[model samples]
Target chain A: MTIFTNFFYSFMASLFFALLFNAPKRSLPVTAAIAGIGYVVFILITQNLGSKPLGFFLATLIMGLLCEIAARVLKMTTTTFVTIAVIPLVPGLGIYRTMQFIVQNNYEAAVQIGIPTLLAAGTIALAIAISTFAVKLFLHFWQQ
Target chain B: MLNEQEINKIIKIVKLEAQIILENGGETYRVEDTVMRICRSFGLIDVEPVVIPTGMFITISHDNLATHTIIKRVRRRTVNLSKIDAANLISRQLTTGRISLDEAIIQLEQIIGDKSKPKILTATASALSAGFFTLLFNGSLFDFFIAALCGAVIQLFSFLLQGEDMSNFIISLTGGIFTAVIAITATQIFNMGNMDLIISGAIMPLLPGLAMTNAIRDTIQGDLVSGVARGTEAIIVAIAIAVGVGVVLKTLILMGGGLN
Candidate 1:
């Protein structure tokens, strides 16, 4: 599929997820748009880094930040929007990769990928946390 | 026409209106102002509004029956006052010194307890089920079938376990593990991917990633208590699936089991 098509799918998927959580109607469009942007960014980073772990790291961080901004702009709970946005970023391939390693009895490779996957998930979480803190701080200072 | 008792009743009605709005995820400031306006409309000019952060509460007072009638009229047409409408109406009586705070609390508890049970359960199940199906399909047809099944099962299980008083965490964990095992087995056995990616996609509704993402987002958003609680619950569910799969695979290896 074309990049545009892919982004559309990503956006719709995220929107559906957001709706599941009963996200405010106003927030859905913004969340979907940001999530699409996150997917595109991930694709570009992956292509450039050529499967390096750092590439995935950067992509997740970017996605997290984008999601946070979308949540703030929509004035909805971050839990609903961010969760939906991150759906596309899930390492489905990583799980498959880990399964292949385990099946092959390559314990070393499995462990390596497993730890990195865990870290990758953590990096995404950290990015969201940092961005939220920054936004809150900015709001506090701006109000004063 | 407005007696003290009626004035208090109107005030209570407004407070309940504010509480319902906030609980449905409105901002704190908005709810406070809404409550204050309702009081003002009821002619409680000297009403000192105390803004409490953690607990959602509103109080209104009216001087007489006419004021209560007016407040009732305003409340009936108000949007998004489902849960706290009754409480707010009662609180107005309290504020006019018609009823004691203890009475107001008892009434609030009874109204909230009775009204909230069905709505909360239904919403929670629907949300979780919808979330599950969306993940299962990765935006494909398989999501629809699997989501429906998972949603039904989760709803039924939740309903049954409501009597047992199990938490959402336990329900989600058990549901996740069951879904994961079924998905893995279906993928290996049926080769459903060849026909529109059905089997693997069906399992998508059970993914733990959605919960993890939500947990992280909540934590980042400063709802640390709920975030940590949800995060831990999600992690545990993930680990349960991993362990369950690991054990099954180990058993199969020992038994010389092969994919049929």
Candidate 2:
């Protein structure tokens, strides 16, 4: 129930952003649904794998793949759609934590949280990029 | 033989064709010259064209003449407006709601207009910036309703103050700083969640981080020129955002003032 609720909220938030960006009217509802499902799946996997560094990397990779597939199916711009949909998965909390540490003058803890936050964001982007390239390659071959 | 520019002209001409047909109340023959004029304007000088015949048949009756006359007027109006210049003029007049559709169509036929691209890209960028800020501060629900209303007002302000050539880096920086101040104030006044989270999350849309990542990826993939340009732009935007926010925050702290 908790997971379901979280997914619902995330979907609503993402969908709201998608519409605000003037995303295609037809795709907004589907994008929001998939994003919610993606969040739930991510939470489940992360919990099972524990908070290990490797687990984090793998989870982000899978999330990126899922987002790419959704993007292709929707036939829309990947950057705009994927970026907005993946908001729920972003470590926004981590960024906040880092800022808090900085305000308290805890330079060490701030660095610790900030570095991981940056890495997480990069990993998400990397996964999306790789998946996007793969999708393009597949389309080329299919066309030929 | 149609060049790229001519092909674009034809597309614009075809879009106008629909409006002409509709205004003629479904008469096909009277609007034929408009189509030919459009083709000529596009420099399709030596062309063999086929006309697909269409007509409206009516029984011989007293009421039919009035209908036929109305249809004739519509068809004549269609032919007159079919030229590219007439079409362009009519399109603009219609868009601005300055003239009736019938009059615009008549004006369209007499002119072969040149195509002019608009210089609104800079205005588009500024509007996007303001939209991003509104999204961050208001969230999805409220932002959607409010941003659109605010966007038009802000657009005029941006146009007058900065013009279309205003730098994206400067715009993003100012937006980010404004967003941070608002977020911090809201958090304090509402006793919201950690100020850090609210502030950071709110400004995520304005971050140059995503742009940097994309730029690096493109560079690594051998798109050197695009990568370098995007990377440089991202770095500049990021520096501007950080400096703008940092200065404001530092000022507040130095003055022994807090958001609360």
Q: Estimate, for each residue in B17-106, the C-alpha lDDT of model 1 and write its tens digit.
A: 555544433334434555665566556654444332234433343343332221221111111222333444454565466776457656
Model 1 agreement with the true structure over A1-144: per-residue lDDT tens digits: 457866876676566555544455666677777777777777777677676456655666676666666655643445445555766666543543454356557799989878876777676666665666667788899999
For all candidates listed, what's the TM-score of chain B alone? 0.45, 0.39
Give the per-residue lDDT of model 2 (tens digit) for B168-191: 555556654665565556545755
CAPRI class of candidate 2: incorrect
True contacts kept of each: 0.11, 0.12
lDDT of the structure predicted as candidate 2 = 0.49
TM of each candidate vs. truth: 0.57, 0.55
